[model samples]
Target: MATPGGVEVIGTDPAEAQTVKLLSNLLWFGQVVAVTEAMLLGRATGIEPTRLQELLAARSGSSRLLERDYGTVLRGDYMGAFGIDRVVEQLATVREMAAELSVPFELSSLVARVHEDALATYGPVAGEMLAAKLLEERSGGALALERLHEE
Candidate 1:
């Protein structure tokens, strides 16, 4: 079946599927950090309220699009069948990205801790899915940042 962006879904091997999930999650998290940084920059720069409103609207639209994409992914087992090792790998990537970005170390550590706990409590499939969803949302937020930069 065609996914939201008109992309065809393919059956993925367990290992490859896990990698995709991890990469997707990493990209999504990066997007979130980028958007958050942009928002804070805009606020600090004292951008006019009207302009801020426009940016926010654009961000919201992008978020919806990401949500649709993520839903399509979840409907397939491509990532769902991944093992715990894959989830750990994905988390490590996220943590590394967060560190490189200088994303408040404290916050990053907290998020990592929480993610570890979630994975432990829920098992790999559920944990990975949740992480994937968050990443998807972040990707949308990143699109919003691109829009704002263009404007």
Candidate 2:
């Protein structure tokens, strides 16, 4: 079957396939944190949040998730397509999997905590960008995007 982004076979076994799926989700979750932090930093340094978002999207630092979620983030829609609670659950699953493999996952553990904190603050409402919202809130409204006027 064809999809927007060509799909690659991960593994033959269902367990392995599921592992890959969880890993992919974990990567996206991490990217959300990174991109949001970068945007917040840009704001702190006096760059407009929207302009910084554009630069990041165009620059080498861009990721598929960042590009895909751009509009949603700008509009503050956040998890309009998914639940923050689900994100926390997935991160927890990935962390558990890593633990079972005896792998050291300090960074992943931190990423999981970011989402856990978001889930705690937002109560599992829709908006994958809740972590971003959390950061913006922490920054005292520094990362809030100016309203984009439609032409």
Candidate 3:
């Protein structure tokens, strides 16, 4: 398929590939938001065990969904299915926003550390790409999550 800027890439349809990449980026951003929110909530309200469990369950469910989608895209052999650099850039943006908004340092630090580890292990680009892919799969359809909870 023809990539933008005349860059040729192999594997899945270019549109599909781009969609996967976009989804992955969204997922990563969501994860950062969710984690930061949860941390702030815990600090402010003192999360009960049951609430924590619910949160954990939700996080796990989301992660699983993203993993499934990422795997599918990878198995489809999409070359540009992931974009790590974009992820890092987005993360930096998130950090800046949090600082400007006066978000707690602890939460921001945690996010930074997590991203740092991810970058170290997966390399900046690959790590973000993989993370985004996994997150996208986990998010899935909203109905799917509701049904999962019912089951």
Candidate 4:
């Protein structure tokens, strides 16, 4: 892939590639949980959630996932191009694999629970972004971008 004008593609052995995929997906699942908490915390402090996302994007808190999903969540756009059930299933599978490997995977466990809770609350039909609904419940407010400008 590197032959394609500086588009680099690093190859890993199968085991490492699977490990990388597991960890990468785990990070994605965990991030939604973390960002949901961060938004709720920011709201609790009277800062608009969208403003917090902007501030984070300009600071060390930024990440491609955070910047992208932050808007999706704040806009109340749960149009999960991907299914929540699949994500939750994957998270559960990873956590189970970790356990069977006798590896400590506390964060994976937490992420699984968070996603599971979202599914329980919103049902299987809801978007994977239902993670934000947990925040909405906690903050007693909708996680919508329009609310940010009013503040």
* Candidate No. with top TM-score: 2
Q: For each of the candidates, give the backbone clash count.
A: 0, 3, 6, 0
Please provide TM-scores, in order, for all candidate models, with all chains considered together.
0.35, 0.86, 0.35, 0.81
lDDT, candidate 3, 84-146, per-residue tens: 565666666656655798875565455555555545555645444343333333444111223
* Candidate 1 residue-wise lDDT at 85: 45
Clash total of candidate 1: 0
lDDT (Cα atoms) of all candidates against the true structure: 0.47, 0.79, 0.46, 0.76
Off by over 4 Å in 1: 1-12, 48-53, 56-89, 93-151
When superposed on Cα atoms, how far off is each prediction in RMSD?
11.9, 3.5, 12.8, 3.6
Weakest 10 consecutive residues of candidate 4 by summed lDDT: 1-10
What is the Cα-based lDDT of residue 127 in candidate 1? 32
lDDT of 4 by residue, 79-135 (tens): 578677877888887888888999999777877887898887777864877777776
**Model 2 segments beyond 4 Å from truth?**
1-8, 146-151
Which candidate's lDDT is highest? 2
Overall local distance difference test of candidate 2: 0.79
Q: Which regions of candidate 4 are displaced past 4 Å?
A: 1-18, 146-151
Better of 1 and 3 by lDDT: 1
